[model samples]
Target: MGADSGFDMVPRLSQGNQDRREWERFLEGVKQYYADDEQVEVGPRVIQFKAGEWPSLPMEGHKFLRFSSKITGATAAKTGVENYIREVQELAKAVFGGRIRPWNELFDVWGFYRWDFVHATMKLHNLVGTPLESPAVWLVLPSRKDIATPEPIPLTSVNNQGNTDLYEVMAIPGRGKGLVAKVDIPKGTQIICEKPLFTLRSSAPPSMHHLVAEKLKLLPNDKQREFLSLHNNFPGQYAFAGIMRTNALPCGPGSSVGGIYSTICLINHSCIPNAHNNWNEEAQHETIHATRNILAGEEILISYANEPSQARQRKLRESFGFQCSCELCSQPLQAIQASDKRRADIEQLDETIGNPVAMMSSPQKSLAACHDLIHVLDQEYGGTVIALLARLYYDAFQICVAHGDQARASVFAERSYMSRVECEGEDSPVTQKVKGLMRDPTKHPSFSAYSTRWRSTRTARPRNVDANSFDKWLWKLSG
Candidate 1:
């Protein structure tokens, strides 16, 4: 869809110099941001922040230079909120486009500045932080805070219409009455339909705790006994928790403590995951979706995604004392060997792209290689390749700017922003920062003036492109 880029029919201030007093006034508005509690609501219950909630919460490292709020005395024709939004949007463009200098270089640079905003907001909003980095300047909207809640949604159990033995007990090695495919389950089919035995309002810890005493304390006495009776790797009461630790899926928010659902945790791990768990943060829910079809009696599987390489996947599976017989992990020796070679090639390219010396020595070549790897991955796996490509695009943006290619830098910045939105969701810090940078690459304080050395303006388009412009790849929209 097209974006809103048309000029407004209202009078505006000079874009060159934002007066010192004006800057102070903007800062003052930011200081009172928390005071307007009515604008933001959060927490497990989906509470809305009333205007009064602002002052109750602390705001130490939350000061922002840019402020967006309607002036109280704004004319009746335009509400204060509308005027405020317009002012901020225009200011964002001018400052990002180089029409005016930002408050400080550290607070003005895209990556650094965007992180500061996201970090501060996350702290205040009680949102959990993941280990991923964003490439844009993203602001949290009042409407889209759904991904924060760690609770699982109550999903109706899938009916066992075709198979009478839906919950039939079977002696599966390593796991109890496991749910095997009753028939050839098609790709994207729901394999198992089981509810969480009990929902814990805590987050997951960094490692497993297999000691019976540790597990016993967390569950009710009767439930603890039931848990002990379940299939386990350890025989004695001492390592029941440890067996669970080895088997359970780590589910919950980034903070507090995480919980393990007995049923879902026992499905085991597979490199070529037959099932995938998707968490809906805002709704406080999780749903496991099937990736591909499974044969009758096939064991359901899920991936850690921690190990992308086949060798690493084997190592991980072997560490758990089970030889992974999954199709991807158990491919023919030659095919497995070929897959490893592709993984090694991708890794080598990653190291070369990440090398400081290589980046500075021939950044263009490094970026081109990174782009080629991303293209190859996309051809093989579709949209799953976005996360890596997003990071590469952000890296390319920095490289382009360093080499004085503003136009190319701008293009990369936009691609980085869009890719991040798909990978990490729109509310992510990466999206925020990239969006800010994409708005105006040339205005960036770090923008280099040495265009001659960079000389990247040589368009990928041809000079004599009058006829058959449709034949060019640039005209086609990305799918």
Candidate 2:
């Protein structure tokens, strides 16, 4: 049942103005709400709200709550207050067992804190590994039941024309731990689909330290050991926090949270990486795919930073405490200068094509610039920039379709769809929409808005023309 306030109340630290009594009242409110449930047993240090069968929250049916006294702010300095807090904690432990002890210990070390309790309709689970050998807490919120219980994808299976077991963990010369292709991996092949060991909020509060430590204590012995053994570049008193910062990848669509995967973290960074890692929300997994064909023994690399610019990438990687000596960063001065020039040109063209006035005034020029941008990106990053290429093709598709150039629009849409499927999986919404547009360009949101100046049918295709001639015709490029 919903709270009497019609909203969940989570305790928070009041500003300097709020007195201790206000905090006490807030604590009492939380206790009363949980106590109201006959199935829930409130103890001095912990509270256990049993999982109910009926739907109480938004879209979720079953719900469970386990709160520990470690969440309280009582201290030894406040004699009576400390006794009250201990009583609450002991009561919780009596009903739920000593699981709250570790949580309480962490709280003692990291000060007490509270978070706002919001209704979560989805089934949320804290995924853990063997007691001693795990990464961190992985909070799984699956929109569908199937996503929560994903089918086991074989590591060696040749499904979707990819061998997931193509890579092996190895120590690289400069990089500490890196993935090396055990077999020749072709472009667009799914390399790995790793479920996170644990996940944390993207913008967690300082009190997250205690929360994480508590979660770590809940892991099986082996899992906790594995988590503690993880590499932490940012060494400090709170080692768990450092490990999280070093290896967690963005999890959800908004990237408001992060997840840690054991095997995926082994792959190191490169400005011009041969592979890319994507968070597949639909499948509830993190997928790694080869951006280009990788030869056996070649180290697998992925860009650590989203910025395509080399200078920015170098600066960004520095925060991770490592100098990237990848091909792009370690290139000769002459080669670097040339690459930088091309990158600058690509940025300028991207700006021009994005400008509404430039597009309206000279659509043809903007289209040409898009082509130029693609050429430079291809020359610089090869198939690794397939995601960028897809966007460029979609832009061209929109422009051509708007001007009633159905033939070119169809071709661009096809190109866009293929590239998107190669980068993001076919199940992706963007890829699916582009696939539909390839079949019928007229179905596009911007069908023929501007003019029918270069009108052509969706069936238009070059016949008997050489590959070079076909490309020229497709882009309407001059000799």
Candidate 3:
């Protein structure tokens, strides 16, 4: 082959390009191969390029290759274009020494974009690629500069390390034993990162007794004692399964698996909790963050239930074998009625904010829904509730991103990152993802979903305004 030939121009080593110079030299060599069909475009936060056939892609058929860092679309290997897809995949492997999948495998197989976590959902639903509400409900949200000067949020780790000085575990009046703060704990402080003594795979209740027994046998003598010491709601029946059922916490939100943490499990439940317990995937441990200031000698409580007061009471009784008499549950008749109304509104808004189809078809409306959810949350809790707000802000980020709005997306990501840190600390994988989004919202796989009508660059953010102006810009509210 001639020196100008594409095959000889680039080194095809398995280790891939060793440096930028090598990759650039290789790109120059192969320019002739894709000269006819290729296009390259560089943006403020991302680069996009279309290239020739993939010679060795795993999928059948040939396909055109669009390599991008910010956007993803449903791409399947077509009869003639599979070669391009193969070459792109192999070339990426050759350059980065890893697989580079810009599209979801399931989406590629299904020939549509109905699957995937629906971008930013907390309720976890497979809302189809069709709109749940009228498409015209999508109000055009205005983006104006009305934001306060941005402040930095520092990430901290949960380094409690089983230290007892932060809080002491002791008997409570009627709620058995719980943790009490020995010193004033500030809001957003992650006071504990406790590793689970053992984790249980999703299984049937009949087998849990055997499973728990086997796991208990494997623990150290003291850990085994600690496991046995945990409160068991089931008295006459089986001991191991009852404790496992009553004390085990889900490894993470929406996770079917459960883990038993000796200390975290000991902290009793409250409907109005001062601390938030979250499982950090990156840290492989559970963390408890103070959602609001707690005075010394006060109880450090985390919500074991996340349903409405009535619904949560039912859940708590059925699952954990307890009747909740927390502040919200024991409120005066008029106040209890009001709290339930606000909480029910929150659930509805929460589901609406997570509707992917609604978000894509009417992003402005979804953005407005996010605002409404936060408003209700502020009323119900009176201040920032890190756990709930983190998911909502992330949903807002994805809503902006689906329509190609980067300036607002970045702000939402920043807020989401702060919430993640405050709820799960900096070591969480979710926090890191949000941090990356703050710099380049396009890094999200869902960017430019189906429209770029609201497209704007990161630098397109409005300046010389207070935080309110930024808010108006973000929500597309007019001054």
lDDT of each: 0.44, 0.57, 0.61
Q: On a 0 to 100 scale, what is the lDDT of residue 444 in model 2?
A: 66
lDDT for predicted candidate 2 compared with the true structure: 0.57
Q: What is the TM-score of each predicted model, taking all chains together?
A: 0.44, 0.61, 0.67
lDDT of 3 at 91: 57
Residue lDDT tens for model 3, 1-479: 00000111111122221233334433532343456654533323222233322221111111112221211223222223334444544655453332132332333211111212222221232211211111112222221111111111101111122778679777778766778899998999887788888987545466888888899899888888777776676654568777776777776543445778767776766677788877765667877889899889998877766667778778777767778888777889889788888889987997787655577678788889999988888888866466678877888888888789898889888998898888777887777877988999998766876589899998888889998988888898866
- The better-scoring model by lDDT among 1 and 3 is 3
Task: Give one digit per residue, the lDDT tens place, for model 2 in 1-479.
Answer: 11110111111122322223333333454466556555444544333333221112111111222222222233223323233344444543333232232223332221111121112211232211111112232222111111111111101001121244798776667566678898999999888887776777533334556666877877777666656666666677766776776667766332435666667767777768787677766666788778899999998887765444566556555546676667887888788777778777877887777654445456788799888888788888875877677778877787787777888888998898888777667876657778888888898644665667778888777889898999898878889
* Candidate ranking (TM-score, best to worst): 3, 2, 1
C-alpha RMSD (angstroms) for model 1: 16.8
User: Candidate 3: misplaced stretches above 4 Å?
Assistant: 1-161
Off by over 4 Å in 2: 1-164, 204-207, 214-223, 237-239, 252-254, 306-310
Q: State each candidate's clash count.
A: 36, 33, 25
Clashes of 3: 25
lDDT of 1 by residue, 402-451 (tens): 55666667677788777655544455454676777776665544455223
